[model samples]
Target: MNKLKLSGILAVIALFAMASCTQKKESNSPKNLQIDNKILAQNLAQKFIITDGHIDLPYHLKSMGFLDLKNTPTLVDGIKGDFDFPRAKKGGLDAPFMSIFIPPALQKTGGSKELADSLINMVEHITTSFPNHFGLASSPNDVIKNFKSGKISLPMGMENGSPIEGDINNVKYFFDRGIRYITLTHGKVNEICDSSYDPVRTWNGLSPFGKEVVLEMNKQGIMVDVSHISDSTFYQVMELTDVPCIASHSSVRKFTPGFERNMSDDMIKLLAKKNGVIQINFGSSFLTYKYEKRLKERDSLKRIFMKENNLTGKDSLAKAFNTKWLEENKLYADVEIVADHIDHVVKLTGIDHVGLGSDYDGVGNSLPTGLKDVSGYPNLLEELLNRGYSEEDIEKICYKNVFRVWNAVLDHAGKNN
Candidate 1:
């Protein structure tokens, strides 16, 4: 009748059910399993700090048409399905690199600079409004110091390179403003280099301007992100930067090769050689091969339709159906898929060069059930444990590897200590 009574009765029923199943099959052979404390830790280390390399909260704040960014919970509600402070705190996300995403379309005019300004303003708003909850960090030391001071570090990273607006000096300008990393392009190619998702050819690999961007970012101690660049472009980037570059939100090409989302085995090995980390992305489309292929196929069909109907510009076509499909299959991807990639990277490049980058709020709605947001990080720890990862290894994947890389970039960049 009461809560305790109800719980005990349910437990008896569950035990009886399990006993019946075991009675039916006299085998301890393993299948799909749901593990509890004997197999999982109830109170894992609270001091085990995990840093997510990517979370697009600032961009979502601006684009979601919200004026007040003061209340984090309210903003989380507005996201409908993205991240928030409470969710992140509960999820063990100690350090989150908030992407200062400048949309690719905005790069055409002075829009790049305008977008950068707006995004940077959002970062300022987060720090100023919520000082106790967040702090702006420039280097890995900033992250450690901020975290130890009882505040979460919300560092800024330039997601798209168009923000520099062709001026290499501004790369240093961003790094001075606590911007730690920069992705060369977005979904579309920019003045600097070709896009991995876009077919249009701007430069075969890193263009002359792109070369300068890499060199300058390396010198400024900003980590170069090669997530959205083509395979040719990735190799070219490897050649350009003396320091290591990160695939901040990417997975293994062993899962999906044709899709530009994941990197090849060769790339992984090379990334290790430079002491770079491949933070596995948790997007369902990127994790599932069939879903990724289906989305690409749907988009290709839509392109053909666009050409056939003499469509001049973009409006409201059914081009984004793959997005809908991804939403439907979001459940198929779980912590196991995430662990699988981490395991592969560890096996290929050792555990030092693999990490977690949720890519939250950037992709469409297709996240694993447990790893749905910043709050769901414990699920990853649980999976890694099941996969036989040591506590030290888990902590490394959580943040140490990336932190080490960050520190390495700082030393390599020859920044003033």
Candidate 2:
């Protein structure tokens, strides 16, 4: 009995000593850069896996022929983009859903299956080609397996419903190919639904085809994503989807109404009741109300400029604008702003429905300042911790609630998702 008591006492002492040491390390670091913040932030994410539900890796890689993810360019080096395997590990990022973003081809020549194939090829190329760094995650078990194997999760998700091209079988085909969720639309209307960001309201709400698509996704056990969807389409999905859904990356409409990229308080409330989570999008336009107006105005002017220059609908124009602005101005959203987005969702919908989806790679150079890379996640946590968020709540925002929803959807899906 004495020996057991001694062992227990020693264990308690060791734990205290370790915690005390950790606190000391955190307090002693004058700068937030590379000062053991990883360990501190990870401790906060332990209640659930530290996860960012959406990451546009394939799109970014396809768009920008950038260097390998294993070797990323840091913010200090003035290289803007910085999400890599090492950084994700440092951030305790467990399950990062890699979005297979299908770019809009006006003609719709290749068809959804071919596009799905391209997306799958990109995912497979990343996961199979580099086994040491990443793994294919199809289910919650896959997440655990990859985590245990010291590998980053490369979950496949579809950003635009067009990949299904009005066909229900494609939804199941996507699931079989390891797609877990499907965003209803993106920037424009498709056969499935209308987009909130579209200048012309294509369907006002979900079309009959859209309703069928939602039903098929639910039957297939896939979580329906409502992020780039029109308000009516959102409501339709809301009423129709039995499984919990999510806004993979969206902001609060109250903060920036006309942007139409963020969800309203009423929508947020409904999402909460429906057991859905909205992973806060970290784009500057999404965060501040002013930026939305600014972005639209600037984008409009740039479009006129491109048109005058005979460059109609050139996608590369946006990239050029981003590069120009980043080089010319010091204006960038801070890590606090990201925390503010998280706080907004927490304030409007409570802590349960909020999650982080940094929208890394997709936004290119527009990432939140201190959070320049996956490694910079700790800075956001420190800001959150400073704001009086409990370790438990942070866990839910970081990953627990997301996982809970994922698991709940899994239960609903029964066989897949």
Candidate 3:
């Protein structure tokens, strides 16, 4: 063969060899797992102990105006709400903190304690009504034990501190009642701390009584949740808390600029420094700035529509109008956006400080597209897999990080008490 012809033949052989190697590598990648993403996601979900930092099941049930725990649609099918037994099982969610949410109005009406107690009763009623399916998890050990027995763990976290009724001893009272975490305030300023949503700046950080509450909480082993409090309150709590803290159902503020409801990059870094965790909120508003604006506009329009039509919220006409408006201006985000928030946390801190806290049922109908309910967790796992996260890292994101914080709180309590 001529020299030029021989060189061309050699290059063709090399190209063929390279293509074969590339094909082999592709087949062996994590993307080539058996079956579809749904199955792979299911497998991962089952393989790990998935713990969500917050869920508003108690409030959701209360909003329905009644409770028949065993016979309720929530324990059965739960097509309306974001969480239920069937969906939780399918998603492999082992532990979800049942939010004992106290509305801010209750503070003025003087029933915050009573309302909080009722919700706590409702949570206990679930395990009493269906012993085999669900059980109460008061600690990290309890969660693991429940997971082993193939049952979902219902841990409780109070959404607002108003239930404490300004008494520091109520912190221990709640801790004894299976309340594992407490969001200092809700959407309004309170005695403990100011809320991110409230204009009043209240105590600036923590009130003298709020400082006592923080110490009592830490000594009692309750996780100080910085989800709904103002930025100043978060820093103050971090300063006061001896044990690791958690932003139970919050997303990074980087995505939604000026949204104090979400944690800023500085706060995230500081949280990680305290060995704390920021469980990413899956709500559309928490994930993107653009969607937040759209949600506001939609709400404003809905208000106008209600007034123009003389439709009270109780009227069917108002419900229909609100439904139609949501359908017309759907600003749903993709599940991948949630993964992006996780990525942001992981990049700023590490895999050890990020976890899932979907804010399910609490965000109402504002859930993201692919992650509309409890069953959509696998979609999130599939996204993480696509992003090249290893099984160990995924496990850390699933539960280990939060478990560490939970255990740390317990340990701190042991010493402090």
* Residue-level lDDT tens digits of model 3 in 1-417: 999999999999999999999998888766565345557678999888899988888888877765445444448545468888899888888999999999999888899988888888888988887788899999989989999998899999999999999878889999999999999999999888899999899799788998999889899999999999999998988888888999999999999989999999999999999999999998888999989787788788878988898888899988887678778876877898999999999999888999999989888777888888888888899888777798899999999999999999988899978
C-alpha positional error of residue 345 in candidate 2 after TM-score superposition, expressed in Å = 1.8
Shift of residue 291 alpha carbon in model 1, Å = 2.2
**Candidate 1, pairs of clashing residues:** 91-375
lDDT digits (tens) for residues 1-417 of candidate 2: 699999999999999999999988877665643344445665654325667767887666655653234433232223335567766777777788888787666316656557557657777766766678788988878888888888778887888888786667988888899888888888787888888878777678898898998988887877888899988888888899887888998877776766777898888889998989998887776777766455676677777877777675646765687568657655567888888777877877678998887788787666667877777777888788767787788877877787777778778777644
Residue 187, candidate 3: Cα error in Å is 1.0
Which runs in model 1 stand beyond 4 Å of their true positions? 1-42, 67-79, 293-331, 415-417
Name the runs in model 3 displaced over 4 angstroms: 1-22, 25-38, 67-74, 77-79, 296-330
lDDT for predicted candidate 2 compared with the true structure = 0.76
Alpha-carbon lDDT, every model: 0.78, 0.76, 0.88
Model 3 weakest 10-residue run by lDDT:
65-74
Candidate 2 lDDT score at position 161: 80
In candidate 2, which residue ranges exceed 4 Å CA deviation? 1-39, 42-48, 65-80, 292-330, 415-417
lDDT of 1: 0.78
**31-95 in candidate 1: lDDT tens per residue?**
32325421343234246767888888877877766424544445323346567767776676778
